[model samples]
Target: MELSQEELRKKFTDLSQNPFQQTKFSRNTKIRKIIKEFANFSQEKLRLENKAVKIAGRIINRIRRFGELTFADLADQSGVVQLKVVRNKDFARVSSGDIIGITGKICKTDLQEEKNKQELSIEIEEFIVLAKCQQTLPDTAHYKLKDTEERFRKRYLDLLVNTENRDILITRHKIIQSIRQFLDQKEFIEIETPILVSEASGAQAKPFITRHNKLHRDFHLRIATEIPLKKLLVGGFEKVYEIGRIFRNEGIDARHNPEFTTIEVYQAYENSEHMMNLTEKLLHYLAKEILKKEEFEFNSHNISLKENFRKMSMIAAIKEHINLDFSQVNNLEQALELAKKHNLRLEKFQKSIGQVILAFFEEYVEKKLVQPTFIYDYPIEVSPLAKNKAENKDIADRFELYIGGLEFANGYSELNDPIEQKKRFEEQTKQKELGNEEIASFDKEFLEALEYGMPPAGGLGIGIDRLIMLFTEQNSIKEVIAFPQLKSKTEEK
Candidate 1:
């Protein structure tokens, strides 16, 4: 039976004890033992009224006596169960949200009106006040976790009340496990890299600034695992992957988080084409193993893993989707006019051909890409770390895998020339000076590692959170993450 805060406090006061004191008993462990014992006893049709110990959890709700027995709903992490309390026996001791345990018989009830046909019931014979609740709980029937900020602040409460929210996070764990198993089968060794770095390099993303108290120097959080993972390749590890957190000081959205998990894998002596095949197989395998099906729906779109994914060049996609000829729209002015025609938002400083192309793709092509598609051969200006295509010098050997209108993974043939890397870094430095915060910074150590003769390799990164969201059929990234970032209460106006 559940007890209310007021009832528990009154009981504690009557017993000459404080209700808010912490206890050493772990509820989760005790509950599991109780479940096991009950399951065993139920197999033999044994009455558990006297044998069962006081099982305690927060009271969910209470219903008046119907016919002969009074019903109370109680819940813990394991699951919810109905409790039948006999009338005229210290019933005032129980209230909503109070922690109480009832020693009762384990019986089944025919819940004809409810969704579940069979319901577990406890015929209460005795009870104990475990701990008194001090605060009143909000009404859970019409629960309002509307404020995204508060949802993060009280994630434990949110998970306790919402089963779907809990399920999403559990699905994320399964997806990550499937990913590790898939890579392990492909002979990939998992490795770790430093989060604190003297110089942040690898991708064109801004880093979170931090200070060292003892060293009296400023450092940046590693924005990407690209450079270190490549260094592992140079160190003679044929296949390696790192599933770790990467920090980027950027805007927050459904697809973007300031701190997120990224899986970076590098295969030595392979090109982007090989990585594409590996990417497809790994994702398909994860879907099959984790979800136990190759077909699923995302936002009304039917996706099938059995069908071959569409592969298209960036220019080809733009021409086909936007109905514009990229051959004529080669300059910034022409590109900006096309972006305006498509109603894609473009900043004044972003008036470049590459930036405009990206804007156009985001507005038109991305939403239309319902199935798995690899849009490859990106413009060289935006792909500094990728190798240039042999046949097309203007484009790089980079491909982004999109499914259900969301980019799932990105892969490229890694650029290994030290001189060319240095030149690209210089160009990025110039862009940084122009107030482009996402430009990659020059890392002398990375350049030095490149000069040490790294092998030809293909690298890929998958957003683990987003992939989990896809499999779980959740629309928001926050739904999959157990605890996402939120602004402090003090920051609110």
Candidate 2:
């Protein structure tokens, strides 16, 4: 039952008072440490040693069988361990959801029906309530809450009760750690880029705008960590990477979030092929390091992270998926006719044949890519920051890594020509003027940086949250995110 505020205060006031005037418990060991220390120790060895230890964790479960003895499970972040406590007035009052400190000696417990079987346990000598639980938790501990919103709203409670949720978060952390370690080992320097910019450009997405009263100017939360990281490339860094948050004024869906995390990596003197190969290698390494295997299961699909991922051009994937010959789409009118043939809608600003090709792919081909595939040679109109192919000016030297029917990574052969870059920005400006909300702005400073002569480079961006979702077999991006944005409950009707 949920306790009232006054009742909770009274319970806490009583808990705060110490009758014995004893010193508060100081934790010298964790429950996980205790388990690890005695994991290999036998019953005879534990009895002979009688190791005294101080451990701290939350009381997750309580079993009352004998009149004088109680068995409660104590859980820390690492794992849970069994605690055997002798019943007393204070001990009997201890309930689940209470943070506790215990000083105990290690021993082995032998239950009935198994005379020779014994398990390691802690025999409590001193116990104190480190923190008392005031409000009651959800009734179900092992089961999920019926309201999915509650899971994200009260993540602490979710983590406390659901081991699977905690494991997904832990896996997310390890994936990021592995990324940093992998980049560092590969001689890539990690760098920090600005989160707020005068103009949000880099990817074709609307930005969250904010104003600064002191400066009397507006700033946009970064849409992607792309332009600033490229500025580092212009400043002569061979390889640099940043894993940061990006905000987008866009829709929220199963795979997308208003605010998300991505890692943008740039390597000087590299091409699109180099970035694709690096992407393949990095994910392969992450699979082995994080999952302890070369394969993982997601949505009933057993994905293999082994070598030799399939590579296909954007037009080829379109053809393979729907038998559409996009290579013949050389002009806007022809492309529109083909799109109309396929019943795919096109925006007014998407007047180029390349844009129409992209529209067809998004509508008909993207979901068909169920395995690890690199869809390369994108339409130049869709990839503003990428270098154009020398042989075909209509297509950019770019690729997007797709796995489990979701785009995980995007990359390109960097465009360093200032003149060409300005022209591309002007084209985007025209599109934005034509009511294309998902278009990048013209960053004059980024253009100026290009004039200083950046070398031919490769750049890649991976949505860290989406990758975590895939690794943890979570379908919604919210499941991997600890605290996702939700509509306000206090809004007026």
Candidate 3:
């Protein structure tokens, strides 16, 4: 029988005001560890049944009643276990989702074997309601939280009901753990950089801004960990990395989020080639060792991390995809003509040959890079922080790893020359004046850091969220992120 609102409120108030003592459950074993310790639950391998166990978890199912006998499934983070209680009036008051503490013993079920499968369960001796779940739970047959927006909005309920989604988060934790292990084994020191900064000059992206009350000036959330991490190279750290949150004020899409995670690694005395190799090794290690799979299906493409990733220059990729040779384009006029021919939108500042090539690459080549690939030598106009190629000054010595048509990692040969870096920053500011709204500020402090004889280093940045999405085979970025930013109530209309 369903209880009235007043009755439910009174029951919860009484329980909260006079709860039972739970001192015995202070040392309760996790459900997962308990299952593992007593390996087999079969009648033949019941192992030692002498020891009593204390366990605590929320009742996640309807308390099945057969006369005086009661059965419920208790769940904790480790996993779930069955509970068997007989002739207990206290257990009768508890409903699904109510947290309970139980003192029990591992015992084989008295139920007859159905196709040779009888279960092991915990037979409760003592019990306490740790907390009461006031509201009634959804019927077990229709427990899934089906609305996508609702799932994201009320993530706690989603995780509580959907075990599969919860496991995705678990796998995300494992992937991050594996990354730390891999980097630690390679002798990389993990360091923390500031989330708020005076200048957001790392990557070519807009930043979220907030005011500092004491300083009386605005600060920007870091769009990338590139600048401060590279400053560590200036501070004499040989191999340094940072794994933290990055904020970008951009349009949220299937792959983009306002706040996301990135792992930026910089190694002194190394160039883009070395970082490229490290990126490949890291991904390979994660696939072959961590995930234990050489091939994964993402976006309907079977991406293979087994072989050495294919490498191509930006111009080469454009030529291959659109069959237009950027190398043959001699002047800005010719580039503009090509842009017009291809129906590419070019702002006033983006009329340069380099920007035109970048526009072409994005429109033509990115989606076709369905397998593991390293597209290097990005356009100099678009790569302000990356070093320009010695042979081709118009191209930056940079590489971006792509899999299943999405960019996974970006690495480059760092520019140690203070004069060139200063020039790049100045040019970025100038570009902003000419209608390129997304450009880095002229960071005088970072330029000063570069002037102190920083080592020629290789720097790499990988979007940790996107990597998790790829590994977990989730199409949308919101699926992997725990609490993705959503549209406001006002905007929904």
Candidate 4:
């Protein structure tokens, strides 16, 4: 049975005047009314219309009337609006999480105060029940979404009722947009690379493995966007970049996601110095465009883009921050002893001098880099794809940008020498054989690409998630990622 407009108005008037004591008006109602008034329509015209509107979405909130007006708000990807039932009979039957079509007048009312003046609002006139909610919503105000496990499981709800959370994800899109615009203006062609590869040849990160039944071969999810993007450089593309997902079978934390987005770019005829400048400019532009400010806060630390970034070699950084000269610590054994002196953890067996120094830097030097700094001239053992510095045979022409104690960007003057590249890949293979799990595997195809006479190019890789986190002032990467991986609730007993 359908109630007429007069009856509905009477019901609403009755509920508004002498509503049940237990029922209180929602805070959003005033805002809705303000929107209605701003739309400039009367309540009568906004009243229930006979036509059925094809409305669709998840039910955000529900009202059940025992002695008061009750209803629920439905939200789709488009937007959100409120639903109400002033009559007790209609309200008693409806529940939250119901999908429904609402037909009503687009009315206006002065419900919300803005700038010392009451403002008009908008709302759905009358709603038809589509699907009823079965389970009760978790307490959303205080007890809601505190558990990391549950939050990921109920990501939809987390996005709802949390505007700040939604904004973080929206900001990520803007960050990507800014990068695309920046690169496109610089004539860098955007490209897509295969996600599943015969061999992963980029970063020293564990790959997620899968077996292809038809091919009867094992394949790995690409660990980095480095190899293929560089192959384009060999093919004579002057500039190229890929903003895409890379998979790594790694531990999860506030900083790390198993699958994450990275932007890898390469420019022919440029070196590490050019890459450093590009890194600074790109990041500064992203911060300015996406955040609309050159300064922001992250982890209680204020970061400014007004000044040029501090640049220091890895050895120089160790000397300045650790007070231990890398010149004095000449070998792996001495470096390991120094690490132990600083109470830094490392494998008991033989490790390369590069690994020992890196472990020491991670422990002692990285945290002290609270501002934007370019830590360059990395040890050749760790940077296999980077060219060796001409003056220092031990250090590669690589630089990593750090801000707020998080590594944001890494770039290098690429190793274009096919023979030297082969030797470096072999070293990586040797390291892998020695039980270092995160070592890059030898890729014959990538070496073949280099052998085809690749140009001297500069390349960079920036962790998109971490960059978004910093710009949005979010403490956790999950906040900026819309559907970050969560432990499956079904797996829980």
Candidate 5:
């Protein structure tokens, strides 16, 4: 039942006399600690002798009789404890949705069962209204706030009611913590980089544009952390890493968000091979530490982290799945013919044979990677920033880790040749001019940094949100994010 304005006003009036607006209150113990310190709950005593403790939390559940007795569960982020109150004017007006501060003594019921004996209860000596909630909570044994449109729009209430969502959020924090610990042990220094840039050029994705009024110029939210981290590499920061928010103006789906977080790591004098080994060890550590097992479930698929991640070239994967070898096709005409045979859609900007090979792999081979797999040796046409192989100029030293048919990480051996890098940027600029909306503009400053002599480096970018999804067994990226992007209510209507 929703609370009317008049009903809410009455609640406020009842709480007004207690404490008008206090700056601070004393809290001697948390609910979890109280339960931990007093484990022997079988005592017949009504109160802990000489033990006066103060606690505060929202009242979650209640059972009451008018001016006789009241029992309610007080819940904090740590845990919940039962409150025993003999009805009085002070706390008899207390409701389930209110936040209350309690000065209490610990006690236990005389129930003989071991399970009942373990339950700790608190006897309240004083009650003060911390905050009076205005609106009625929209949750019950049958109805849930999750069924309403306001769930994601108002996430604080959702966290209060949804146990699984709360667990997913807590798991996310631990996942990032474990990642930082892993990288720190490897001697990787974490750095902060600018979010606003003149041009976004690290990846092939459209950027969100914003304007600066003072300068009367435009800037873009960074689409990737690759460029600036590499500039740090050129400046003699041999090993650096950054985990920050990245923005891309793109379509939203189960795995994609406009603004998300990524961790990009760059190590001088390392190659894609070193990155692969690091990726394997990092993921295995996260699984063992966070999930507490090498095996977990995602979208009903059993993902085994123990197995050595299968490795195959992009071309090999395509040939295995679709039985078509792009290496055998030398021209765009032959590649286009093979694409048609496999029913692949062609974009106007995808005019080259290598581009067609990438399209075929995305359309046919990605979904086949149900297990943890690495698709390596990408074509140079798609991997503009990766170094080309010495023996074959057509393939770049890049690998992407895929699990549950989703791309989780992309890593590459650094392309240190200034002249070759400039050529690649020029080609990308030409493509942008030809109306490739997803292409980034040529970054002259980044090119200048490369000209200053960057060392051979290995770089990797991992989507922190998606990794959380995998660990928490959530199917959608929104489940892991606290406040996911949602269309406005008017747009929804």
Candidate 6:
């Protein structure tokens, strides 16, 4: 007889009120430990010893009765173990995906199937349902969610069904913990910065704004932790770093997210060269020491951290890629001709020679950086916070780390001169007036801090999600992020 949907719900609810109960595991052992400790023990040995153990996990397989003996697979965070129950009356009502506590003895299964050929298992003496699985689950044979959109929408279900997803999140935790340990060992102080700010003056990104009812003011979610952290440099913190959320009103793609995490580190009395070395050491530590990995597959490129990274100037990189060196181009008219030759589209604010060089670099050079490469001496128009080179003010002492053709980290020698910084801010303001919405804000407070005499420093920022994507060998930013923003189902339809 076919039971209706409501009937099935009622039946499950009634069966969920089972009397077999334990408040918590007083002496529970992990299945991983058990398997490793008793792999040699046979069924005869386990029966003779009769040493009992208690374990609790979610059921991964439906209970099956063969010749009055019941069996199922139970899985915890550690691993999975097979469960055997004999003559348990309540066992009939137990379902797959239910959380259960079992008092059992370790043994090896002697089932007829060769697949169960003396596999280590446990014989249950008593069991209780901790939680019932109300909804149906995907098949346990190869438990997996079918739709990619649904997997992101219901992350719990995805995590339950996919072991890889669970491992990725676990690796995320370990990587962060290892980073904290690494930085702390280097005498770097981790500081907390405010999420809401009066100015979004950090990077070239649109800011998310919110209204404050009580203060009768508008505030922007911080696009970067650059300003406040640099303020700490003025306050005499020699080494400071911030690992927190950053908000940017930006487009979402495989490599980009609207909301993401970044770690910005600033060290006084250091130059961009020192920060570049630090960036390399940090990534090496993460790959070799922490993750026990020397190579990564990201964006179809096999990147090795063991090799010394390549360094090239931005103009040099563009020249190497397309054989067009901009060093000889002396003025704006020549740059405009080159831009027209390359079919480069330019906005009103992008008409300057430096901006045109940047447009050429983006068009010709960026994607060719497959391995770990640092493109330094960026055009001044694109690097507002970086110090200008003494020889030529057209370029700044800025470097961006690229791996797998993706931008991973950025570092630069800090511009300590308040007057020069104000000039840069004025330039940005002029660009904004000329129809560039992503220009850095003229942060009066940050300028005030710079005026109070900040020491010369080096600063670096890493996109945490992109770093994890490389470490985890995942291609999409969404795979590494726990919950990426998604369109609503109604909107999707």
lDDT of the candidates, in the order given: 0.79, 0.86, 0.85, 0.76, 0.85, 0.87
Residue 343 C-alpha lDDT in model 5 = 81
lDDT of 3 by residue, 219-325 (tens): 99988888899888888899999999999899998999899999999999999999999999999888866579988889888888878999998889999988999
Give each model a TM-score: 0.84, 0.94, 0.94, 0.82, 0.94, 0.95
Per-residue lDDT of 148 in model 2: 77
Tell me the number of clashing residue pairs for each predicted model.
3, 0, 0, 16, 0, 0
- For residue 373, give model 6's deviation from the true position in Å: 0.5
* Worst 10-residue lDDT window, candidate 5: 109-118
N/CA/C clash count, model 2: 0
lDDT of 6 by residue, 268-301 (tens): 9999999999999999999976669787677888
Model 1 global lDDT (CA atoms, 0 to 1):
0.79
Clashing pairs in 2: none
Error of 3 at 188 (Å): 1.5
Greater-TM-score candidate between 1 and 4: 1
lDDT of 1 by residue, 292-379 (tens): 9989887568888887788998778988986877867767778778777767887644656876777777778888888899999888
Q: Which lDDT value does model 6 have at 149?
A: 85
Residue range 19-99, candidate 4, lDDT tens digits: 223232212233333343434444545454322233445555445233554445556544555544455364444445545
Q: Which regions in candidate 6 have their CA more than 4 angstroms from the true location? A: 1-23
lDDT: which candidate is best? 6
**Model 1: runs farther than 4 Å from truth?**
1-11, 14-57, 63-70, 87-94, 99-104, 109-118, 124-131, 142-149, 327-356, 488-493
Instruction: State the displacement of the C-alpha of residue 173, model 1, in Å, after optimal TM-score superposition.
Output: 1.2
